[model samples]
Target: MKKWIMLSFLLIYLAGCQPFMGGQAVIDWVDFIQWNGQEYNGVHNSEIADASFIEKEIGEVRFKVADNVSNPSYQLKDGDAAFHEKGTKLYSIKGKDNIIAVKDEAAINGYRIYFAMDNSKYKWHFDDVSLEQVKKIEIYKSATPAGNQQIATIEDKAGIENFLEILSNSKEAPAFQPNTSTGDPISYQIILYTDEPITYKYSVHYDGNTYFWYPSETAILSDDIQHFISEK
Candidate 1:
């Protein structure tokens, strides 16, 4: 068996820039692979409906392995994103209500992305996943940045403090003002905080979909947060 090792820091983000204090983050899409040659019917909840029998219930996420008759460690192709290094398989997953990106690179490498169910509060399980009837997976999109939207960054604590100070002083931060780009009034703020002994610093992220907030201990990834970032 070719044991897979995790890749760290696919992308990093600024903790201060995020708006939320504590919450879940979502991305647009994620990618994975299937060994067999197959086509997607674009069916709604096709995986979920099929695996209803062995479904493991978390708060909101329901997981069940369909059938693992196929071979393990099948290789997948990485597309334009350069997300996966060569010789990687990707796993993909989707959100029931909204399409959130999967941050797990292992799953992503195998063309699979894992989603967390906050409300369900139960950790998901894929211990006995079967890969039959599934084949030819493609990552049409990513949960992080799309074409027009950009993923910005911040580096040091002083930077975060300065950004926050600017927001507090000007009141022109996205949260208080109308964004000129999309013209959407800043609904929330994204706060990214690094390791600090005394004070907590933050930034303002005004993106339409995500309300990110990386705490003192966490790291900001390419919107995916969990799978794409590394904390030191």
Candidate 2:
């Protein structure tokens, strides 16, 4: 009776553990199916099925219907160098053998920083900003005749890390308000892009524009980042 009881307990434990393993497979399958459809349609797609009918292999997996009326589809096609999502033809793996791993979107793409300051009132130009250690930079004016001139580009390594630090350390102010008294007022916008992009904008207040992008705000700006923007 004790042996039978032990066997029953073992069966219960195994049953309990199945869901945990199955949960992970479900998550992986969800990722695989969406990725596959993204490749076929050239647009993002949603997952439609559960983990019930996935077949896992040593280095690959097939997604299929339980009844087997439709043909099974290969979701992951593992290659010697990297794991390829069969549908998208995009590499999901990062690095080389032994050190190989899944790719991180944020780390691989780096950061894109965009700065736009009112050209009419402010004298700053993208040319004035320093880029000694920056990886890549692009400068352009807004298509609008009166819109702010813009600078946008990507950075990585120490350059991006420093920029992130500055942003995090900078002081926060109240939500922006436009100057009603003056028809034209100075405005500024700084946009940083990573996995998620953030925007920071400064505009003149009704009373008077109090924000300064230099000396006071300059404390947040690294000397390696830029030099002069306005005379005052």
Candidate 3:
């Protein structure tokens, strides 16, 4: 009777702890996560099902218990990276590694910093056309006290080049999205008129801190550009 009771107790204990043991404790999903005091957000991933292990092995992400999690799944802990739906926490990603590609079929393609060992690739890709080819840019605001309105129109060549320079230096975010949950979103409508037959339309999204080209994967507004636009 004693032997049988001991066996039953052991089985019950094992069953209770089973779900927590998957060889590795990876969360099912997380919007974003804080690691080593830095925030990585706006995660995008390509699901290569049954994909071969990546050999690039850029960096590693270690999950630790924390008090705050902007995204629910992230607060739970998992890989080192944060993304939207299919972001994976990679302990060791393959490549120069850690920077994830964000591709938009409509306008542009860019990259986001993900689990980076250092802040190297965290700048906008700003494939802006040559300044000489640019004619002017018209700026507008969407959420305003007077409703959407034209804010400024920049036709000066020097001003346009200055804006483009600042944009190139703007910092790249790990994971970023337009957050309108608080106040009215800080947004701008940028219609760039160029010499080419194509007139490019971009956005200026201010998250109370920095500005981003909302539809883009990684285009942040520059300070000089911000000032330049403000003056206009």
Candidate 4:
């Protein structure tokens, strides 16, 4: 997984620059997402939503006049007029409510561009999950060599019911923020199979003190789920 680029700099406003902070920053970055079939590398996604779940848009953005495009890893300013890179995926999470414009080299390889928003513009509504319809549950945990390896698989009726109950009770959290921080929180992935051809995916994140599902839905992992992590 690509860690988000954290550019920490004191804002230095300059004359003739855009109204916002447009001074020459001491730090910068330039990278595109590299998708290798199964995984997206070199970019840290702002949301936990899978690529299939997002509303993607494409467009080009000219470099700001003050930005030195020659610098490989310099930070771009979204001050007033223009942004830095050509946007590949302008992800609209909730019908344009919470939109994120990504600058990636999707034409060549995947590149990751970062944008920050202060808040999510919409409240999300998830479809009701039916426990009986879930045929199987695959649980994966973080590791060194394998990265994310299967820790447990649930096929029994009782086990599936318990897991879903825990998931349903998850508390909501603040989902979106425009942060350029380098910290990557630890997370787990769950792939639930149902009677239908469609599959369900959920992410469990441990943000130091609390464990919640990413995108504002999370709870304490049940002992059954935690046991899988412990044993693995």
Q: TM-score for each prediction? A: 0.20, 0.23, 0.40, 0.41
What would you estimate as the lDDT of candidate 4? 0.45
Q: How do all the candidates rank in terms of TM-score, highest first?
A: 4, 3, 2, 1
What tens digits encode model 1's per-residue C-alpha lDDT throughout 1-232? 7434221122222486674323322222222222222111111111221222222222221111122111122222212121223333223332342212222332222122222222322221111112222222111112334321223344444544444333333321233332357654232212232221111112223345432332222222233331212122
What lDDT does candidate 2 reach at residue 98?
13
Candidate 4 weakest lDDT stretch, 10 residues: 34-43
- Cα deviation at 200, candidate 4, in Å, is 0.8
- Supply the global lDDT for candidate 1: 0.26
Candidate 3: tens digits of C-alpha lDDT, residues 63-119: 433222223322233343333333323332233244332222222122222433345
In Å, residue 108's CA in model 3 sits off its true spot by 20
**Global lDDT of each model?**
0.26, 0.27, 0.46, 0.45
Q: Write the number of the candidate with greater lDDT, choosing between 1 and 3.
A: 3
Off by over 4 Å in 2: 1-148, 152-154, 175-185, 195-232
Q: List where candidate 3 sits over 4 angstroms from the true fold.
A: 1-128, 143-148, 177-181, 214-216
lDDT by residue (tens digit), candidate 2, 43-116:
01111011221222213224321222121222322221112232322222211111112222322122111111
lDDT for model 3 comes to: 0.46
For every candidate structure, what is the RMSD over all alpha carbons to the true structure, in angstroms? Answer: 21.2, 18.4, 15.4, 11.8
